[model samples]
Target: MIQPSNKNRIVYLDVLRVLAMLMVIMVHVGDAYLFNAETMTFETEASLFAVLLRSSVPLFIIMSSILLLPIKKDNTSFFKRRFTRVVIPFLIWSIIYVFLPIPNEIAFGGPANTFTDSGLNVFLYNLMMVPFNFTGSNVHFWFLYIILGLYLFMPIISPWIKTASKRSLIFFLSMWGITLFFPYLRLYFPQIHGECDWNDFGMFYYFGGYLGYVILGYFLHHHNRLKAGQSMAIGAILFIVGVIVTYWGFIHDQNAFFKTLALSHVENWKLIEFNISFLSPNVVIMTAGVFMLFQNIKLSAFMKRVFTELSVFSYGIFLVHYIITLWITAWLHNSMMINPGLEQFLLTVLTFSISYGIVKPISFFPRSNYIIG
Candidate 1:
């Protein structure tokens, strides 16, 4: 069984949280290359690494569920605490990104200019639709919407999870496994369509989507009985399989696109939509495997301290990292002529370091935790 310390903190989870945040930076860094590829080629090692980084967001969701789903608090108290923690910081950062002077060429792929009157109005409109359509200001803000939706269901599911047996949890996971294939099923069979509509009551809806990862988090934390060796072995195998599937899937998609549309056009990048979804079965397995692998690690004192600090600032880092990424990547592109692969790697490091440097000091200010945590 999983156990927290007397203070109720799980150190391993802290490590996982830190790793997940770093992985998010990696994904954004990879985007600089993956999205801007000059040609339709998926055979590059950088592309494969980008595919591997797709697990980052799913891992974040899993970590959130593992920590939040076991709470015994009532819905009112839960919402009051959780919403305040996430939503306030979200709004603060959303507004910051909305007005930040970063040019669109760097921040996004538009012309090299700050917001125009029409752009500002559109940004404000999207902000006005908060908690529903958040992708307007920042694409990364989509995670907040998903988290908010999951939090809405947490109170209703918490009690059930507290009393749930292993078999029952397994059954739910199996149903979730089936739902993971829905994306691929739609790809091959476009006629099959429905939103978890089992009968009219949406009974299966409870067992679908990222909810499985949430429950998986709780289950793996509290109910896992696997030996350390066994867990690592299973995790390693799953991760390998996930990598193969993701790499091949994207390659196949890119080749098909190149063949269908002449390969001469850089604009005809078909591999853009071919990677495994975060909700794909491969990602689920990979995330579970990685989570389990980390669960069995014994961190050294120095490493533990580093992870603890990173975890504390992780939410803040997530909020601010994108701007740092855009600025740093733009500067690097303008000032230096380097390999795209090297640039991506350097951008990831610099973005994470600068973002952390900014957040670490802000974390000490009065009422800063509400903004950063």
Candidate 2:
């Protein structure tokens, strides 16, 4: 999910790394508003923002693909370096979140239900599941799993990536694009393209999931470097259209749900979330928009140095930032002093600062990269 500092780091990649992490923080911060809002039938800032911010994780994936695909290193070497930077730190944080007791609601005073188990017996049981799953409390870790899969696939696909013509890669992406509509297809028919409950592997399953983004990243890497103005102009249109489709789908679904469904199910909002599924076409468009828009960034000297450091510690901050997110966002909103519009922005900045502060010092200790990454 994160890349290491490189001797040949591209400026925009570093800048994009910082923006991607910040966008991730924004997503979490916005969730505080969404899950705790008074009504589910209407759009809030969080819901509006979710349409655009769904691109956050995909951006990271594309960036990882752009940076790591056509993998030069052997499998063992690549896994050694990537897993050390990602999985070990992930495991460490998983343990911390598992054992740490949050006996009260934290997400804008939403739910304290992350870790209900206590003591060694409970901790051991949860620890045993670490290799398999993370609880809803640590939902962000889901990205970690997707990324690990991509990492595993990277070396295996490197040869294909190296040899495949641009046309061939585009063909793969086109096939994957068909799979993007599978979720909707499931609504009208339980199965499609040779898929069923038993046959989860459909005709295009091989071409779907995050793998397309990996191929896209590599293909786009070889694309002609468009002028900054041209790229941003086109990217902005795609980004706006993506946002409109996502938001429209969200609002339409929410209104329909309210008309037919009872209001008691707080989690019913997930039904509405179906519209914004990250695997869908809207997100893919937004992801491409972000990839294009960021590639042309030109940072000043001082800002570049600052972002370079941020880029290095971004993964570390991501690991620890969620710990304080709900708690801080709740306080900010419950305070009633900060502008409602600004709560999310302030929460993102504050959480980023706090997480960065915590990780920066730990990064100095020996072997801490393996721990704090």
Candidate 3:
């Protein structure tokens, strides 16, 4: 067990972290065979799976807020922690991902590869870009920028959040409404972007989810506010229903634009295409279900203990898992032939199990311990 600290000990938060990590893995695995340009074999493959996977990233952002918001640290200290713990690992893993295919593909008489081939130039270029802007498969590293941004501004924001007054909640809800609604509002107003908007700031979703979950976490932590049983029951019901609706939307809709208007609640649909990235009712509902389940569920003691061990590696896993998943997908696609649907399902499982198995064990390497934990 983690020792007592100035921070509150919600054993559940660790469980949440582990769940978020698993969600991320599931999202990527589903993405690889279902929607990835290289692996997608059939037109009908990218169905409800993409929508449901959409919950992963937002849930991760919310989980970050919950975990970090309670900590008492200055901005400088926070940066130092992240720079060492997050930024450094991100850079190292990004470089590794950049170079991974050379050895594997070279032996098969495939094309040669390098950092530029893998888009590392774009990744490195973003180090100099303005905040909230990115240019490459910085892949999963974008969250670090959001986390750092929030950490810097937390001292200013936490005061209002802590008050827990109706006014504060209203202010936050208003911000959320404007940010979440701003882009779609553009479809009607066209000039809405000219108005003062938090979405214009680009950090809005990250800020909104961060602030929302953190403030919510603080209240829950302080008051012991959640009842796991009731919350889980409600969340599971909504999650399943959301999945069904999201599936129906994808099957019937062809235009990416109409689909966004159709299914908004599923989680990983952003990977489907750029136009579908905007807020839709389905997207919001499904993501809410993900957050609810994350916050409310209880885990077995054995599972919780396993999560405690693995959650330390969560950051590293996120950073490296994409490349690992991609490689596995490519290998399976090339080496063995399977039916499209089974291939998709097996690819998902193979990618998840292999990536986690490899990374989780490597995460225990003594030299890597400082980087992962």
Candidate 4:
């Protein structure tokens, strides 16, 4: 079993953070081009990339679990650190997004327009709605709300995790796995109406949702006994299976929706958007495999430096990268034609680079960490 020290940073976790953030950008790039594609071939290629990158957010969740589940610190310190690091920036970014104009091409698929007319009202309304809603000005900020909810439960769950036996952890994970299938169950068996409740007892409630990823991270980090070779083999198989499931699932759904509803190509594409949810079994599997693969990697000095720099600015990049991605994608959309795959790759790179550049300067200012970190 490997236990992470609170004082010492884990190199593999840093690598995972860098990779995950890049994947997040990749998915956004793919979305920009794929949704607007005029050719089935381009859409198909982009969809494959998007599905493969769906594990990006799950990786972030799992990495958070690995770092926070051990609970070696007190609640006061934990809350204070998390608040300054996460909550404050989330609020700042939420406000920024509220006033920031949505590109009209991206917003209404027409000429661009600024939000100056009703920006104040929009900001106030978003501020009011943020507490109860995840769809603040930026759709991607839903992650902030989810992570906050997870943090709320961290203190409550950490104590149990500290002393949890392997069997107990396995039981929790098994229940979590069962809950992952609930979406499909509901889809196929609409008549199954009752909740998994036994006279007000939330039997499956405690063992489900993103909490499963949390516990899974802790289990893999603390209790996993597999060798590097074994991990590599398992990771490869799981990753391949996840790719097949996601790619084929989306394709199947898109075709079915087109045939059944006789919808346009873009409308059919939207129908399978839910296929990329983090709760999907394929995404979970891919996230686990990728996490395990990184766990077994030993970084060289050059790679370590690069990963560390990117990891340090990862939070800021995540908060700001969407804007960069959208602008670059819009520019590309208006510019000369290029291959969708290449456009996505270029957009992702540019977004990451520009966001990193912007954050790096801001990070040097006094107390800027509160806004960016």
- Maximum-lDDT candidate: 2
- Stretches off by above 4 angstroms in model 4 are 1-7, 37-42, 105-123, 191-203, 259-271, 334-337
Poorest lDDT segment (10 consecutive residues) of candidate 3: 103-112
* Number of the candidate with higher lDDT, 3 or 4: 4
Each model's lDDT comes to 0.74, 0.78, 0.55, 0.77
- Tens digits of per-residue lDDT for model 3 on 293-336? 76755666666666666666567667666776666655665345
**Candidate 4: tens digits of C-alpha lDDT, residues 1-373:** 1122333678899999999999999987776666543654337777788887888988888889988887778999999999998888888887787677666423422111234355645456666666656443566777777788999999999889989999999999888898787777767764333554344334466666888888989988888789998988898888888889888888777676657557654565456755666887888888888887878888766677777778878999998987777777767753657776777777788899999889888987998978898
Query: Tens-digit lDDT track for model 1 on 1-373?
Result: 1122233567788888888888888777665566434654553756777777777888888888888876767789889887678888988888777677663433433212234454666566546556555543576777788888899988888888889999999898999998787666656764443433444324355557777888888888888789989988988888888888887887777667756674433344434554566777878888887888888888766666677777877899999998777667666752557766666777788889899889878877998967886
Q: Estimate each model's TM-score.
A: 0.86, 0.90, 0.71, 0.87
Q: Comparing 2 and 3 by TM-score, which wins?
A: 2
Q: Which stretches of model 1 miss by more than 4 angstroms? A: 1-7, 37-43, 106-120, 193-206, 257-271, 334-342
Candidate 3 residue-pair clash tally:
8
Off by over 4 Å in 2: 1-7, 37-43, 103-125, 259-269
lDDT order of candidates, best first?
2, 4, 1, 3
Best by TM-score: 2
- lDDT by residue (78-161, candidate 2, tens digit) is 999987899999998888886665534432222223444544454565576678776545656878888998898888889988
**Which candidate model has the greater TM-score, 3 or 4?**
4
lDDT of 2 at 210: 86
